[model samples]
Target: MRIQTILALTDFSSPAEQALERAALLAAHHQARLQLLYIAERQEAKFCDPQARLEQRARQLSRRHQLTVQALPAAGDALAALHAAAAQADLLVMDNRLHGRWRWPTRALGLLARMLRTSPCPVLVVQGAARAPYVHVLVHAAGDEDSGGRLLHGAAAMHAGATVELFHVARPRRGLGLACGEAFARALRSRRQRVQQLAQPLQSVPHTRLRVSDAFETRRNRVGLATRGLDPARQLLVQQQGTRADLLVLAHAPRGVLRDLLQAGKAWRLLAGPEPVGCDVLLMPQRGPVTARPEAAGDAPARQSAVARRWTQAT
Candidate 1:
């Protein structure tokens, strides 16, 4: 996953702005070319006003990041416009809508999922506030192996010598084990090594830490979701990327992750805020090869694709 070029699609909302902030951090961190995109709502050909607004918005976003921006207004669907523009992208970053009419179903996550299913590159979707200090990267517990492996592989490949940490934040109750002491230590060790195996070059990439928190405060039915351990995964990734990570990479988790986010109503946070403090983020979607995972005999060659690589630019 070489993110040589990145595209950020904005709807000109606060959420979109947040996505732009994330893009800027990434552009600055990786030194990758950043393209800011705005797709105007379709209007009659005689109407130039919307196109002008779109261009103006694109320029504003581009100037903020100190890079070239591309604002496009098409006569068709907003999603179609974005999909057309992102043909050459290594990654696409967008905010998740959290409230009112700007909720998930209307936002780009579904489109993101469509893109993910067949994207030439990976897609990263951030809604609401994620966690901070992204020294670690977590893959979804039930994600495809390549999706899981790519997170570690990409981190290891990057020459930054940044430590790679991977952990699964499971929903409360069922998936989470509650034993203490040795049981906890053993579980952590096993999961950490599993992450390392995918990360490769164990010596070069150090282990951070992994934890399992109950998604809910208690096992009983609750009025509203109080995201406990696993809930923080999305929050940490979204919030921490700008400040701590040069960039952050994550695969799409199962519906459980999205559901919790929706319940929390943090969708707006996905687009409005400044990027992970100082650092930028790379929100990646799965874009594995035709045979993403292969047998050791079959996979070694592709596995040897290249060490995780980073695209760096001067801030």
Candidate 2:
């Protein structure tokens, strides 16, 4: 959860520029190295010098933010290049509007989802303008206790002084047949209790004590819990809108075939919906076994194994 390096993906669009600005602010805040990656298509490369442009921008950002910045130029497939570049990065920052102008929202969401699934680091999908440092962060907590703790810790680490609220939605069991008001109330109470128990460990830990790194010495972020009815995606949106949170954090776990058939992914639904959530989103992958990085044969396993251990401990 300690961010020492951030990779910002850009196509030189307005949205991409905004995302880059946000990334710069974060890099400055964390005192981390910022890498600007510009992937040029074949046709674009044939006409313009992308490497020069990227270097110029990197210089501007470095001067503005007073941080180390590197310009990375690549040609061909954007996704493949990003995956490769992100292997050593702690976080990937990118605009929600990616690629082709027409039907770009859908395409961008699809691309974002893919990046979230595959990226070795957390992906920050910039939606709103980065006016200032994050103030209030809304985090979605599912049934997984460990994931919730990690999300809380990560959120606290990333935005040190921001207030974080852990939001959970409980759905009643179908076969319970709790048609009676009292029975339904009991079920709701039970679910809420379970969620509270899951979050107790996180809440009990003092936020100021969380020491991811020197740059991330978090203030006492007032952690609170919220439970609501079904339709998780909609409820999350509503909760964010109501609280006016500047950032939303979600765990990007793989969906089963049954879950996909039954409902759209929550992250996809929120990002791709007609009404935007009006907040930046940080997607943390619920990783399983670590994938071997494309590194030297001797060094790759040791490095990847260490990374796996860190992630395991973090969760």
Candidate 3:
């Protein structure tokens, strides 16, 4: 939630520039240090001086945003360099079109999925321009309870003025044969109740001002659920578009399930699919059972207690 250092990866393209602008805006708002990293293609680097350009841009951003900005040196492997740099950062910001295209290569998608899975901090994928501050933040709360709470806290902390809404999509049980109409109705009711139960704990997190919504509600109601036959990923996308959210937050899938999600599941579609969502996306890495060191000092205990209170309040 507390961001002290942000790393923005750039290739000097338009999307990257927009991402940098957004990152600078966040840096200014949070009083955080902003580090600019220019990733150049091997052939392009041979023809131009990347470091000089990177430093020049960093200086311009520093003067413009009135914040500390540093240009990181280029490395041989882009993914390796990014992973190494992200290790020390509190947040990582990058454009969706890092390769100068929206439809990414298989290898690139694999590397990105790996980074999201292993990054020490949250990753922000900028899909749109930074015209203004985010007004609506939609967080996917269908994963681990702890992960969902952490994401909600982070989103609330980062965009304090924005309205944060938590939503869950109840996917129909798989491999089950068709049921009678009455049985199907009962199943639907059960799923809706389960989603409500899952979201109940998040409503009481001490520091977060979250608006929890039932995705299964009718179309006439607020935040209506997606059509019944769609997968959870498509359902989430539909809900995000319906709510007109400026930002969408999701926790990284767990290790055992991560590979499938990245390769052909929801994460893949949202992150690297042909169709792009209207809002920016933030992906939080899954934390382990043991507590890791806090990104910011002096707030670790308070943050932990806040999460603890969420669980305690649920019971």
Candidate 4:
């Protein structure tokens, strides 16, 4: 994907500073324009000139990095302001810890999760220090092949020299003894074979630097009826620790029932865990080629055209 504009939102915290530095690195790498956005708290606004300071920082960054930087400062609801500003951006970069919290049952949701839900483009949640030009990137493929392809494309676009590993979690079947784990392992292997086959042409054709390696680990709940609804997030966290990845890419909720469950449960847990994850996270939206189902024939043409447009740009 061609990234033309990157929007970096900041609350002026240490994490936000790291995000800004990372954003500058990305902008310099992709030759993309940079937009620095800050939403002022009521008390801070009363005491300081946020817009002027924001513009000053922008100018400083522009001069220091020799790249275009635009500073946008706004007051009131931060989420609303960010949503409005991110409309034209290809990537939204922000801190992992921000205002608001996720409320599942209620209408209110955490600012980060809520932004991921509605963002027009992919959202990159940057945590920890400013680690530029990621050396080791990991893309969690899970069960979605399309999402995996998109993740690989994204990784290639962002860091051409980074060692990219596509990791998959295979959940073993229950009540089948050793056979359950073996079966899941075989299935994961088959999936990896298919992914490799699909990627062969991509490596030769356009994404030459997007070569990706693959790995899978089996995760099964403890043997018991009480463990019926085991959480996958914990296992995922464990696997991430093993990889020690610099960047983790994941797809957001898709339309299918299984995907929705994964997103609503495991994905939510991962994002809302008690402790922060080690690496940066990129939450990709659900986007793919339109299906050929006859019931949706009316909209198929438009969807196909849109896909074509995207493919053209990627080419």
For all candidates, the clash counts are: 27, 0, 0, 2
Across 1-315, the per-residue lDDT of candidate 3 in tens digits comes to: 789999998878788899899999999989999998886432364538777988999999999989999998776776777878999999999876423343344424444555666788998988889978788888876543544467777777566567788766543322222112222234336456654555454455444355655344324221222123435566567778778989988877545333553456466677555655678998887675523222446543544454344323322
Those runs of model 4 whose alpha carbons end farther than 4 Å from true positions after fitting are 40-47, 73-80, 98-108, 172-185, 188-193, 197-230, 254-268, 288-315
Q: Where does candidate 2 stray beyond 4 Å?
A: 40-47, 76-78, 98-110, 174-229, 255-263, 288-315
Off by over 4 Å in 1: 40-48, 57-64, 73-77, 98-120, 128-148, 154-164, 169-197, 201-250, 253-315
- Give the per-residue lDDT digits (tens) of candidate 1, residues 1-315: 565787877666666667766666566556678776664332356544666766776677567657666655556676676777688777677764323354445333444435544555656555433333244443333233445566655544433445444433332322223211222233446566564465454364444333232212223211112222334344444334422444444554323435544542222233333322233334444453424222345533332221111001100
| Models sorted by lDDT, best on top | 3, 2, 4, 1
- Candidate 4 C-alpha error for residue 178, in Å: 9.6
Query: How are the candidates ranked when ordered by TM-score, highest leading?
Result: 3, 4, 2, 1
**Pick by lDDT: which candidate is best?**
3
lDDT of each: 0.47, 0.65, 0.67, 0.63
Candidate 4 or 2, higher lDDT = 2
| TM-score against native, each model | 0.52, 0.70, 0.72, 0.72
Quote the lDDT for 254 in model 2: 64
CA displacement after TM-score superposition, residue 224 of candidate 1 (Å): 15
TM-score of candidate 3 to 2 decimals: 0.72
Off by over 4 Å in 3: 41-47, 75-78, 98-111, 173-209, 218-230, 254-262, 288-315
lDDT of 1 at 3: 59
